[model samples]
Target: MTATTAAPAWRPAAPVPCAAPLPAVDRLRVAPRADGWTVTARVAVDPRDPNLAGHFPGQPIYPGVFVVETLCQAMAQAVPGTPRLRAVTSIRFLAALLGGDEMELTLDVDPAAPAAGAASPTEPGWTVRGTGRRHDGTVTAQLRAVFDAGAGA
Candidate 1:
């Protein structure tokens, strides 16, 4: 008996619409301090963002990864010269960031010991740590990352 290998009823599905890319940050403010630098950034969570679409589907919440990216981007803008991320040493999500929530990230950038073998005479490393708080002052997330002071002259 010969077996026929025929494809069964394959129909192309309709194209799904895509959400527009959200900006890295809505507002950014940086200030210098004796200990380090303080960076404050605002982000408006849009329910229509792709990251929220399937994050909880019926109940959308801002993804934690986006929070980290937000902080990293803020650090890049707040620091002198370019900063290259070496590692995310720690991250914690304390509360849920819901759609329509306006979150304020307050990050502190301070000097840190460079990775053991990664340090050089001319370059230094920095640690960025901060918390994301809702407009009402509810802490939602915290993160810490190490970065190399990039491309020193």
Candidate 2:
């Protein structure tokens, strides 16, 4: 006879204090699709954003980390329940996301995947893909992220 073991359940870690709140997305909009959901948001980099301070003295450009953060935030909002980011499969920065550049972010979340709060080790979670583009249709960035249900009381 062969023995089998079930995968261990996943749980959220202890909460850690944060120094400050993460940046916000403006003019955010979420719409449901037949296969998934789409989120559209306007991101206008703030000149006062501390991240831009040392990015470059003379020619400061928007940091790629912030751009990815924006996409993660948008996905969390579009999807139901509290979703914790697990991994970023891929991300690409095509052009500089400069300050004051009102870029439009569009994210697509697969509806066929398990819901955030209902995900399990066997079921895994959901996948989200998106792109940030300027008004002129210039692609600023592209990314794919995986999320799982968050632990909550």
TM-score of each: 0.74, 0.73
Tens-digit lDDT track for model 1 on 1-153?
A: 112533223222212122223454677766665567777778889988876788888888988888876766666666776576778888999988888999888888887754433335235777877888998889998888878776553
Q: What lDDT does each candidate get?
A: 0.71, 0.65
Determine which window of 10 residues in candidate 1 has minimal summed lDDT.
10-19
Give the alpha carbon lDDT tens digit for every residue of 10-49 in model 2.
2222122222134546656666655666667676777667
lDDT measured at residue 54 in model 2 versus the true structure, 0 to 100: 74
Superposed model 1: Cα runs more than 4 Å off: 1-21, 114-123
Best by TM-score: 1
Alpha carbon lDDT at 122, candidate 1: 35
Report residue 137 deviation for candidate 1 (angstroms).
1.1
How does candidate 2 score on lDDT? 0.65
Worst 10 residues of 2 by lDDT: 11-20
